[model samples]
Target: MKEKIESKLREKFPNAILEVNDFRGDLTFLVDKNSIVEICKFLRDDEELSFDLLVDLCGVDRAKRKDRFEVVYHIVSLKNRYRVRLKVRVDEKDCVVDSVTSVYPTANWHERETYDMFGITFRNHPDLRRMYMPEEFEYYPLRKDFPLMGIPGSLQLPKR
Candidate 1:
């Protein structure tokens, strides 16, 4: 079943460079960021693999690794009764990936949360504003190098 699905995906998405891995029960394929939209379109529109649900989209910070961030897209095929994960690695300095909101409108809030927490920008996202973070936050707190302590005495809490 997995082989057939993979073959269909490869045929539909010619530019999608992927590394298939079936570790234990988890099924995932690491793909290039540039081909994300096309791959998603194929998944959702293909009659055989009608992945109608975009379950989730998330960002992971791999600070120690060369590829600093990875964006994970989870989709469920209602017709095929299968699930798949697509991952794309992006560097810290240029952590920009194509938005899937056009393919899946439910991805709006999820993408916003990812952008808020990890500073992974989704290019062409219609409403890419901070979701869970204070608007005044100058930097992303979830990053490894973010300061743990408060700023030096600018607004100290009255000797408490």
Candidate 2:
């Protein structure tokens, strides 16, 4: 099944898929950020693959890598009972990628949370606002460089 999926993905987007990995039966595909939406749509709509459920969406801060951020998506095919993970590498300077809400509406909140925690923006997201942090908060707490104590005066507590 992994081989079939990988072959199909390669056939569909030969240039967009950067790497493929299978570890302990889990399949992971590292793909180009530019075509993430298209690739996801294919995974969901393709009858042979049919990755219908968007299980999770999150971000990883790769501070030292050429691409400083990685947006990860976990998808499952209910019909086939197969799961696959997709990742898109995002450059720190850009820190932006197209929202997958169109492909999977569940990604709306996930994307917002990723944005709030990692400062990675999802372009074209219906509501790309802070999910866990206050609207006025300035720093992304999950980034590697974010100070553990946080920015001075960034948060104001009510006077006791």
Candidate 3:
């Protein structure tokens, strides 16, 4: 099944797939960021693939790497009972990626939360805003560089 999926992806988008891995039955693909939306659309629309469920979408802070961030997507084909993990590397300087909301509506809240916590923006998101933090807050709390003590006086506390 993994071989079939990889072959199809290669045939459709030759250079878009950077790497493929299968570890302990987990299929993973590291793909080009530029073609992510198209890739996702194909995954869902392809009759043989039919990855209908977007299980999770997340932002990872790889603090010390040249590409300091990664956007990961986990999708499952309910009909085929197979799962795949897709990853796209994102540099800190350019922390935006194309949204998958059009393919999977559930990505809406996940993208919002990732933006709120890790400060990775989702391009073309219907409503992209901080989920937990105030609109005016400057720091991303979940960032690796965020101070352990919290940003002093960043959030106003109401008097008791």
Candidate 4:
């Protein structure tokens, strides 16, 4: 199953793939952000490889790395009883990635939550806005560099 999925992706997206990792039977592909939407579409539409379920979508912040962020998609083919982990690295300079909401409608909230937490924007998202933080919040609280004690007066408190 892994071989089939890897071969198809390699053949179809030769230039878009960056790295492939298999740890404890879990397969992860780090791919180019530019091809993320197409790759996901193909993954979902392919008849033989029907990845019909998007189990999870989230973001990672790697502040020390040159590409400071990674958006991860955990998708599974319930028919095939297998899953693939797709990842796209995002640079801090251009922290935008094309949204996968078209391919997976459930991605809407995940993308918004990621944006609110990591400050990584998802282009073409239906409603991209803060999920937990206020709209005026200036800093992403989840980043490794965020102050532990919270930003002083970052948000206004209601009079009790």
- Taking the tens digit of each residue's C-alpha lDDT, what string does model 2 give over 23-83? 9988999999999999999999999889999999999998899989999999999989999
Model 1 spans > 4 angstroms off: 147-160
Model 3: residue 14 alpha-carbon error in angstroms:
0.7
- lDDT of all the models against the reference? 0.85, 0.95, 0.94, 0.94
Checking candidate 4 for backbone clashes, the offending pairs are: none
- lDDT per residue (tens digit) for residues 1-160 in model 1: 6888788877766667568889886689898889899889888988877899999899888889999999999999887778998999999888899999999999999999998888999999999999976676666666777666634543334565
* Reference-based TM-score of each model: 0.88, 0.97, 0.95, 0.96
- For model 3, the superposed segments whose C-alpha errors exceed 4 Å read none
Q: Least lDDT summed over 10 consecutive residues: which range in candidate 2?
A: 1-10
lDDT of 4: 0.94
- Pairs with steric clashes in candidate 2: none
Total residue pair clashes for candidate 3: 0
Measured on C-alpha atoms, candidate 1 has an lDDT of 0.85
